[model samples]
Target: MKHLFLTALLAVAMPAWADAVDTLKRFVQEVRSGQAAFTQTVTSPDGAKKRVTQGRFEFARPGRFRFEYDKPFEQLIVADGQKVWLYDPDLHQVTVRAMDQALGATPAALLAGGSLEKDFRLAPAEASDGLQWVEAVPRDKDSQFRTVRVGFRDQALAALEILDNFGQKSVLQFSQVQSNVAVPAERFRFTPPAGADVLEQ
Candidate 1:
């Protein structure tokens, strides 16, 4: 009877575990465009410091996306298929890098790039907080992140948690998610202000 009960328990749990992986695969393959409001919290390695920022993000697959940070400060990150742009309004600086070099094995690549299986080792993570989770570890040995976990609520993306090599953790909670919807092409395009210092990498 004990063995039978254990088998039954595993049977019930297996599909849910599979759902987490399937959900991520479906999201990557089917959801071509998405926009959302997000709250990002970054915690220090020592747990002594925390910073929170709110932002809006829009992405169209195959290497195009934009993140606009609106609260606590103004910052922007944009990728336009060819290059990635990071803009700091207060500092009047814009940093540019080739899109391929900028996104390798990063969380942005996982969400907004193609070829998921090529970049990361993905697996179902223990679900928690009413969400199914999938954890992805970069296959690249030099990736700055230790692991990236995406959480889904009812098969919709709800959260992303990233742990970096330095032990800092960042959690992004998404709201007002609109998936597979048309996002403007202009959202992914970036032009630095006239006076901003442009640095290329």
Candidate 2:
């Protein structure tokens, strides 16, 4: 019978890859602090082309984070655990750096900060759309998004799919996700809107 339907399709795809690697190890270990509302897409690498944006985010793990980009414009990006601001109120501009020199292992430092198996090398990624995927890869060697695909649905963290190294692709899609709540320490503090135009390093 065709090897029992290929062993029952690997027993239902190996328990959905062990529940999407236990929902991304319980989403970076119990979701310390989070807030979300996002929808981003920027593809271009033979996939025709795309560009959509809408955001509102906040986070506070070991480092910190905040991004508030409304609709197809307006932007801001903070980090404040050492610095990494990037505001652009219609190009009035403000850009700083030094969050370990601008996010070391990238993917926004593995989605806001630290210790994912000490810099990532995870796996288990299959299901799509409905979510449940997880694949990180960047043991740091000057990484600039070479692979990172995190997604989960019921367990939270809606989606994310960076993959760059010339093959552009960035597809984030989170919505109303609020975990651990209570985030406000100035939302990662980025104060700089007086005539703008500041650039540090």
Candidate 3:
């Protein structure tokens, strides 16, 4: 009976792992070709939810992406397939950092060239309310976010929950994700607003 249980566990896990890898690869491939728009609703740890943020997310090969947020706050975050730029119009400040360095705590890194199996290990997760879950833990203890939990529906990423090092949790639920759409090259370009203070991270 113990052996049967173990076999059953492995049976579930192995297929899930393969599915994750394949899903990631397909997602990345589509993203690299500049396809996919992500809309997310962010909820505070206290359960208070903010207005939904809608954006057309575009990705290019090697590590480039643009997340354009429209609603409540208009902000642009772009990683030039290399360095990352986070510009906040409200604060009038732009933060720049190495793309690879910033992927430590976020799930975006999973698609940005960081190998999930290498940097973190994953396991088959639970399903509730029709959402399938996958949990990933960083191999490096010093990493910012302790764990990343991704929820999928029909192989599409439905949500992501991030648990940061400071114990702060941010939950983002996605909707209307369109894959394989053509995204323009200009979407990723950034010219800091006239007086915005640019800070390097």
Candidate 4:
């Protein structure tokens, strides 16, 4: 009787594991655009130091997004399909890189739409903190991130936990998520302020 009960338990638990990866696939395929407020906490490799930042993000499919950091510092990152622009208001500088060179195998690529199976080795991760998790290991050997875990709550994107090559961990918790909304086209456009230094890579 005990063996039979164990088998039944295993059958029930197995589907939950697949749910995480399935949720991610559905999210990537169905949600074309989204905007959300996020809190990002980054921890040092030794866990002795930490930094927190708050931001608002908006993204459209096929390579367009904007991340505007508001607290602690004012910075903006915009991907305009062709180039990725990083602007530092305090430093009065703008940096630009080709989008293809900047986003390959990164979290932005995952969320901004791509060939997921080609870029990542996807697997179901153990559920934690009341969220189902999917772990994505980038197939690009030269990628900066070691692993990226996306967490979903009730089939909605809840959080992203990224572990980098240097052992640093960054966790982004999203709130006020609005999925499949029409984001303004201007959100992905960036222009350097007059007199600000611009560097292109």
lDDT of each: 0.86, 0.78, 0.65, 0.87
User: What would the per-residue lDDT of candidate 1 be over residues 1-201, giving only the tens digit for each residue?
Assistant: 000011346537776666777888888889999999999999999999999999998999998999999999999999999999999999999999999899988988888875677788877777799998888888888989999998889989999999999999999999999999999898898988998999999
In model 4, the runs with Cα more than 4 Å from the true position are: 1-12
Each model's TM-score?
A: 0.93, 0.33, 0.78, 0.93
Find the candidate with the highest lDDT and give its number.
4
lDDT of 3 by residue, 18-37 (tens): 45445554654555544445
Per-residue error (Å), model 2, residue 50: 27
Instruction: Quote the positional error of residue 129 for candidate 4 in Å.
Output: 0.6
What CA RMSD would candidate 4 show?
5.8
TM-score-wise, the better of 3 and 4 is 4
lDDT of 2: 0.78
Question: What lDDT tens digits, residue by residue, belong to model 2 across residues 20-108?
Answer: 76677777778878988999999899999898999888888877988888988988898988988998888899989888888776766
Among residues 3 or more apart in sequence or in different chains, the pairs in candidate 4 whose N, CA or C atoms overlap within 3 Å are none
- Model 4, 28-132: lDDT tens per residue? 889999999999999999999999999999999989999999999999999999999999999999999999899888998888876788888887777899998
The regions of model 2 sitting more than 4 angstroms off are 1-68, 76-85, 88-93, 98-100, 109-118, 123-129, 135-149, 152-158, 161-171, 174-201
